[model samples]
Target: MSKFKKDGKKNTPAVSTASLPDIVFMLLFFFMVTTVMREVDLKIKLSQPDATEIEKLEDRSLVDYVYIGEPTNTALYGTLPKIQLDDAFATVEDIQDYVIEKRADRPEAVHGAIIVSLKVDEETKMGIVTDVKQELREVQALKISYSTREKVNKKKF
Candidate 1:
């Protein structure tokens, strides 16, 4: 006689749930470390000009942005467009200091590679842009870029 009988059905083990929380937490931590957030809360109303030729910067870490536009609160900041450096409203004379401080934050070797991008509103005066350029010259930060929108159809990306 046979010692044991063979059964047609076999039981399958349940799927493990222990590692599920670990994966969820790991994904949360990964996004927290790798994601980049908006640098500043823009107080100005900006409408960038259109451009046919535009080139995207390769490394965002090497570029700093300067924003110029009319204030969202016209009653407080008035109708004239204002210059924004970092989080605060600044004058044309403040560009040198701002550039110097920004350069100091980066590695010495990359200081020369840093580019200052001007995000100017279309309705803004040209004089302010000229002054900002002069200030950059004083700091020896010659690399510059003008931020503009691409001339594309609404449906076309």
Candidate 2:
């Protein structure tokens, strides 16, 4: 029994990190799958007009939005109707090019089906909207949709 005296240097089991990477990667994948990225930060104010007759699009992927309204920073942009493509302010003349480029970005198979949804603010004039339509027509992007909110029923309760 004296020969089996306790040794000062005793080996201790180390913690296993074999599944650490797997757990970390799983977390990363989960975040990647769950995260929803914002398309753009609107520089202009947008309040959709109320509509009595409006239909939702079947496929939203094929749709591109064109925001039309006065700039939120009226001091910088002045109080005038402006067109926003993606995130930047664009002019009426720039619409044709914007449409062309949008078409090129998408697959050719669905170019004809791609819809340009005009999100015009209620305060915005129809002239700007008409101009946008004209540009879309020039590019042959005929499939158009107007973004509007459902009219709330006014009930006296």
Measured by lDDT, the strongest candidate is: 1
Specify the highest-TM-score model's number.
Answer: 1
TM-score of each: 0.74, 0.73
Model 1 lDDT tens row, 1-157? 4445555475566999999999999999999999989889898888999988899878999999999999999999998989998898999888989999999999999988999999999999998889899999999999999999988856654
RMSDs, each prediction?
A: 7.6, 7.7
Candidate 2: C-alpha lDDT: 0.89
- Estimate, for each residue in 1-157, the C-alpha lDDT of model 2 and write its tens digit: 8578766687666999999999999999999999867667888889999987999988877888899998999999998989999989999898888888888988899888999999988999899899899888888989999999999988749
Q: Looking at model 2, which ten-residue stretch has the lowest summed lDDT?
A: 4-13
Clashing pairs in 1: none
Number of backbone collisions per candidate, in order?
0, 0
Q: Scored by CA lDDT, what does every candidate get? A: 0.91, 0.89
